[model samples]
Target: MSGLQPLGSVDICLVTMPFVDLCRPSIALGLLKSALKSSPYRVSVSYGNLLFAEKVGVERYGLQKFGRQTRLAGDWVFAQAAFPEHVTDTSDFAQQIAQDIRRLAGLDRDPETLNRLAELVLDLRDQATAFVDEMVESVLAQTPRIVACTSVFQQHTASLALLRKLKERDPELITIIGGANCTGVMGVANIESFPWIDVIFSGEADDQFAPLIDHLMRSGLAGLDAACLEGVITKTSAIQLRDVSGKDLPCAFVSDLVTSPQPDYEDYFTTLRQVSYRDQIVPGIPLESSRGCWWGHKCGCTFCGLNGHNMRYRAKRADQVLNEIRSLRQTYGIERIEFVDNILDMGFFDDLLPRLANEPRKFNIFFETKANLTRTQVGRLKAAGVGWIQPGIEALHDQMLKLMNKGTTNAINLQLLKYACEFGLRVIWHVLYRLPGEEDAWHGESAKLVPLLHHLMPPTNFVPVTVQRFSAYHDDPEKYGLKLQVAPGYLDIYPLDVERIGQLAYFFDSNLDYPSAHDRHDGFLALNKAIRDWKRAFANEDAPPILGMRDEGESIFILDTRACATERRFRLEGIQADVLRCCDPALRSERLAPVLAEHHGRRYTESAIAQAVEALRERRLLVEVSGKLLQLAVPGEIPDLPARSTFPGGIDAPPNLAALIGASAKTAVAA
Candidate 1:
């Protein structure tokens, strides 16, 4: 294009149906620059892909707390409500969300409900399309000689469809697809399935993409025979197609893609005036220090998709990582950033974090890691300004955890929780349910696991598990025999399995097994039973709005609500009633005061606040608190209350209420 030894390659667009906006663009940029070194083309790299928040509700409209799962549920419901004929797992999730939105909005076929639903659906589709279109146009404007796309989840389908339209307009454009979802699942997605797609590549895209782009730019067209591509599934005829292997594909090409000329972040994002997220765009370039995970433990837990139980870690040079961070900051104006790594192993942290902290950039990073990290590592994370850490804890029950191949024990999980709690770091423990073994554990032995989780609740959590073919049980069902049954919907085997098997297994696709009446009946019964048990025990209870001490701790009180000690007992002789008030808004002063008063006599003093807090603390009825501000802490059951004795200001006047005496007077005097 300009200022380079050009082989006539004008632009290269690297795309992914993104799971997160971090690192991919930067990583792609780095790789693209490396690829250009071998080419005679004037190379320019631009990234655009459909970036999705697991929950569409929050990403599209601004319901920040609305989780990806909840949004998925809402979307599933909307999709079903809109097109029930295409029922799938997504539909069921959507139905649940629809029910919830119905309840939350209090709309029963009313105009308000319909309008809200309509607006939400439109907003979802529009925002999703807009983002997809924006990235596509941005790339198209670069006049790329090559186009590559990747998908990680189902949402990418919409974005891929848009890309196909672009392809239809310009068939000569070289198109390649690769990512977690695309590489593994779609071998050679039927070219007809996506008419705009010229070639669907899988496995690792780094080595494959550069070579293909070079070939396409040099020859103006490249041949795609099944053997040349490791994993390509292409339609050769109206009735038949070919499936090729992609196992031999080279590993990701990790190198500096952009050279001497640095990026201008303001210019880049500013080009798209409406950046997707409205929150403060803490300008931090996303980059990964490594590829794959290092948790070599054989049993990573059954539900884990991270690394597919194959832990591979290739660390980037520490100095290079530090240099990149500094470069992105100085050149691109990035300050706060997130390091999107599977897990920043403790060793990496010990070396990298201290160096990073010394580098003079105040950055805020986000990461998801295993629970086996040490307290020291967590402390490092907090010190590094990591505001969010998604730890994969999966389940509290050992059996369930084993079933998921989560190698760590509940004890280890709890220890991590304790450290995070003590350190006051915001953490979200990712949990899962409905694993294959859950049914066996559900009857009795496993029931205990739920309460165990009570001890380690986090501010954010989730529990979801879907049956899959490659899980230990699914992989070797002959051992379990009749005890293990495959669900119909799970036929869409993960690409990891396809890599092993070479051909698509009928057993993995959801539609195949459920074809017959009896098979479908048995499979569905198993799923439904799991769902029922999960709902009864976990359901929305594990969801967030993290509980605090103020949430009623029943069992101790006469009415089985929050326990209340009588005010008479609490009132030391001649103590004023107004001195004990502690302004904990979490407490329902009106309702709880009478209960507290019935327990502690009408008395006023700072000691009364201390006594009430102390009493509740002793009984374990209150949540763990810091200073005067209280948080609901205890997970279950309040202790027994001592028999009540009558006191003044109604039999149920709070002992601390007396402490309130002249509290307003003090406030007035201060004013």
Candidate 2:
């Protein structure tokens, strides 16, 4: 490490490839750029994703970017250009991609659109080769000594293609690869399968990246050894880093998030302004206040492989987070901030949220949190300028939740939806089916309950459970009554043997014991139909369903416009209004009577309260789940929230109250 080059002597390039969202920069590369600020290396990030999007047309690139990840159509499109010798025939690949596009579009089984899409796939494949050549020329213009690519989601093939071309043109250039996809066995396999990659970091490289660069700059690759780099797998050390079965050795992880440098996003904004489709994108800066999952450390989700080998939760100090946000906002002049944490730190509730809520300039923020949030917490999230959240409401059945070890009940998830709707927070979630140990009858029961929730937000879509590497299901398939194989998509993309493909693959195809194929399809038909109807109802901009309530001194007024509403309006008085008010946060059936009696300052029998509750339930004013009664209507005073469809750009501007609810309920509930 001694006698290294002076600061900013060695040139390095960090790359982000296609299939990544065009609306955000790579936090991984951004952090690395900042991490090398004090070192002798001068880093420049190459935004190849934006460049490719411009070349292939932004709209078409988006179609592949947001398409199903299990299909890996994006990877296959670039695979032809990356490894020409292996992927000679793309006829079958084109047909599979065309069918997938048809499925995603909800199109009928027609050959006309499929034929056009098949041709388009071939055209894109050709464009991909030219795009890689363009990227190689762009990166080489900088004349960097080392080039590193961040591979996550569908960027693997594109990264490989760029690096392969770079190495072909310049044999002395060092090639490095890392990211979520390069963790554990996948990283080891990457070095073993692809001769172009010289070094692969298996875990978090926040603490190790700069030192490795120092070693390379001083002694060059010839002096580099396994002893010099701790968590990195070099080409010479791939065999020693793996066990007999070719799994990864234990790697060290970053223990403290406080020391991680603030990401540099100057390159992203610079490249974005040069793109033709820049106006269509409203960029959101990605920031991470924490890492890993706290809940997963206790009872991990069965199908999640997000944390890799590091499930320990760590967060930056509240002051550090606040300072970072202030600095980023002042520097970038962007109001949209997206937290890339796997799960929100619960401690943020006490310090970080309250601080953000008090800021003068509000930010449109997004975070992922557990679904078991209380009503007050949801309100705080909205008040803190958090307009979007993915609360992980995977299923509506308690049994299915238990099967996934979610540690939450259906009632809790429903309550979160109700509160998020009331507070104008847009929720992004979906239903996950095909879970092991799930009963076919659960779908039927969930379908029956779907209509009762027309006023709330609907799921984006329903997807089958995937067995991912590092997940509990993938680690011990026998325990969950599952048999696993590499997903079919990998076979089309990679020309490797089954064993090597298994090591490089993250998603997998699985077989479960319960819920036969016929039963699974038939049982989900009703639920699928219900969700479709719900989405359609929400699509109507003129008069979407609105179920809201207003509190008057004497009576409570309810306005109902749902498709399943029994009446347009209802006025509740006396005990009925009292019962609805008592159930604001939802109460168990047995506790409802006691709470109502206490509110009225008089003793009331359980039978009398039950009658009132049943009346409200019959009117669709209240719904019961797992013996807990929850008021279905949001407060009429609260304006309508923006759904994901309305604001596809992720910009949640303050809603115009007069436009949202002025026409619907102005006569019903006057101030």
Candidate 3:
């Protein structure tokens, strides 16, 4: 299957392109194929870019003298590792395209940079054209009646180019494309701009693709006949194939994900074995236990733009999830799985977690869950063979959390971190700063607790939150007091003139220009520096503990364990001990004042308690944001990982964030 197929005929060909997380095969293609495999449908999947990554990529890396296994198993390291460092630093595709257009139109600035960038763009265009030709020819060789490409991330341009080429090679092939990139107008824009993309599906195509395929098989590739398939857009007349987008088709199939068949990863595993360093591929079965985020379905996060118009929440039954997971594990002999759900189904705790916990196999799994998970739930997740989680821990301040519409408090986030550490679960969370309308005081207060969190698995990333295409920020900027920057990075990524890129680009920066680094807008810079310093210390195992609790006779001694502490230890008696214990998660100011009054009638005055809180904040022992307070120290040290050394920079200041988002930030600043 890795090589050219022998002459054969197939019903459909699904392709997953380059730059997707190579460690985890796409759950999209597999799920779609499973859905399409009804009575008369035969489905075939081709991970063309993955195959390219394995074969041609290995050969290229060999010339550079990379190690055998490293070169072979390097797909994840090379492709999915936010390897967009080069794109961000200088050779951003859209920026280059925009430059070329300007120069051609007789407007020029740095002509030399423009000339060099133009050359790079031409080279990439040539490469993409070749890839499209190759993929189309390969799929055509199998004689599939239809070819669909799963589009995500930077795969947009390549997918569009391929759809164009597929039609050029054979108009009868019925070219189609869909993914996060194709949601809403992004799809409409591509179809409106390029008429060759025969059919495009927006939003969740799982419900649309199968029925479309069925209709196409029955009615042939005639225009206006596709009116039955909702969310499927096509030209009105195939004879007059112009840049006219077809009527909007609606999605009918909810396809009860609870009872839907398990994903078919036959091709993924088949392709995995073809990787040169065969033993190096320890691929995980990418599973989806739920469709939409249950939490985000109601009061969605303000900054979250994922799920697009398809924010409706749907989850698989717990039994169905466990059965699917178990079947996948037994079938693949691979215990590691990465759940692709936007959020963990709350119902999983009732059945899936407990069942998986009791199962003999102890599979290693990873999931993303809401941060509001209780300590008991976190522990249950840990017990149930879940080794990793991406808890939605954007901030450790209630105000910041509220600004994001995260619906969870700082105390709850802290509690989740503590539980993750206590249960030995690896946490990957980010800290978003410089949020619009956020007070400078919020970050100033949040910075103090940065050092305290070093005991837990350090934040995997910290950067200013971006305005994504489908998020609440982009949906209605005015409602959230956000003025989005459209004529910038969006220009760099897509080739359309200023007007069109605004409608298509998924990522955007604020158009507000900060003339000086000293602006209040620069508050996040200092906070970012503090967080980076904290991360370095944590990585080196040098960060201090946040809490040290002990009972001596009738008195309790609680000490701030953070490094460089003046009052590392504090002794509390009676009422004071009771007050500190109430800081479990956090106690709001309104509630804290009353509780202290009730507990410490005469011993501690309101002013005295306020003074103590200020003292604690000064020592970085307490995170006092607005009225809520949390003891920042979680119970475990950041677990040292073997991949920690793979980070380009040294322990003093690791460079992942700098390599990934730092360049983008600098680009924004320069813009």
Candidate 4:
């Protein structure tokens, strides 16, 4: 919790570079730091991201970090500094990226907007060298014998730039790189491409990092035999580590997450205090209760490549999770906890949520989960202080959901959304399209369905699906009737051959020829427009779209203010009210009829129940998906949930970079 120890007191300095979110620490570095607590080496973490944000202005830094993924703008900017000889000219690169952005984002080619984007890209690209130089000097000041960098997302090029400079400054200083980007073939590619990188760690280095450090301290890099190090990939051992097919051997994962040390985030907090815009930032502590996707283990989503080589599910005990949360809160005096798990452990619903609900102190939590959550489970999540969730609601059509292998139908996805709205939980989700074998009609149907649910939260964005390595589509593109190639943007970012780039690339651009491929454009446009309107409806703080219901003994009152509402209010009684109550958790027509019959002690035919459901659907009170009917109107008063905008220093929107820089300058002058 104290400031970073004096220079020359640190041995292994783990670095987290630019473009990573400054609102949280690098859990990878934090875990490795704690893993080395008992080792002879004195481990320290250098939050280069905080330092770089201070120098370049946080707003501009965020623009690149949270910007369009396909653009790889952050990587391109730092590629200039990292690979100067390769990426010499930017006139063509800038023009190409600008055009790609317009096409992908469906933005009109407005000259001024495009010119401003170009200017920002070039300006940031120009500043990369100086920032990398400053970071190198800062890291060298610590006099660390071994410097390691965690590279994920846009951090790859920046990490390379810093380590390259450090190696140039001190050739004896060991430079190591590892993270999501450096797994399997990507790790081998990095080792082969960058001569400065002395070692590359693939896979989960949780169990291997500390031991590797111990080996280096005792034996150094000379004549080092790394066969015992499970995930270590060095230049000499890189070839030997590959299989007969020349593919790099899969890295071993930690089977038992219980034994892993709780991450040490002291460095993140210490670095945060030194940030010039510290007051503007509300930091959240990142914790992991589980690793790998349990759903993926059974039936992996076709478009997902998040788990890399390891899709086997592993989770710590419920007690371990609770203890970690309490310890982090007590240590940092912060209550916002973000779970970095790919998916919530199903056991947590029965084990962890109940414990958190019973706790005296409440913590705001964010979790990613499946969309099949029942209403009771949703209520439990709300009670457990899980205010935000990414429930993987990727599609709103049954056929589309099947294509993605989501294992949940459109009805279940809608039910989750309705429940989330009713419980005042912020749902972080998006509509993903462009799956192989997708029909144009699916998009049209989704666009039609969007307006009826304006009372619920809109998706964050509508994104075109991209093929990623380790995904079903990428692993067997031919089987899906698609051809995969390196994402075109990578050509502009990395000046490498297509084949070599393919090996290094995580995201791939797919080429599929379907009969309705061209016609699907209009359908996508309509859906995107509908989603945009849904988001706009929530913009006015004074009045938000609302469709809510209150249940009385004899009557149910439904208030409707949604854009698609037919009337201001409606009163349901007798069979209508009973049908609404019966379908609160969603039910098939046959089941609805039986339930309604049991409620009133009278026989109700399926046709009669269907007619009543249709009447409610006409008034936008009920929705039937995949033959199951669900009540759309949320029960009781809807709470005013906190919006993402309310969160301090979120990376979603761009602030004024010049203002941040000017403010920091004034602060330094005052000091």
- lDDT for 149 (candidate 3): 85
Maximum-TM-score candidate:
4
Tell me the spans in candidate 3 whose CA falls farther than 4 Å from its real position: 1-8, 55-129, 223-227, 237-255, 277-280, 480-495, 514-522, 541-561, 567-578, 588-623, 632-671
In candidate 2, which residue ranges exceed 4 Å CA deviation?
1-10, 226-228, 244-250, 512-521, 643-671
Q: Which 10 consecutive positions of candidate 1 have the poorest summed lDDT?
A: 646-655
Writing each residue's lDDT as its tens digit, candidate 2 over 573-610 gives 97788888887777887887777677755466778788
Model 4's alpha-carbon lDDT is 0.82
Give Cα distance to truth, residue 61, candidate 1, Å: 5.3
Clashing pairs in 4: none
lDDT per residue for candidate 3 within 396-430, as digits (tens), equals 77888988888887778877877776677777899
For candidate 4, the per-residue lDDT at 489 reads 67
User: By the lDDT metric, which is better: model 3 or model 4?
Assistant: 4
Query: Which residue pairs does candidate 2 place in steric collision?
Result: none
lDDT per residue for candidate 1 within 508-608, as digits (tens), equals 32222222445434433443343344434432433412222222222221111122222212221222122122222233333344545565454334555
TM-score of each: 0.59, 0.92, 0.78, 0.93
Deviation (Å) of 175 in candidate 2? 0.6
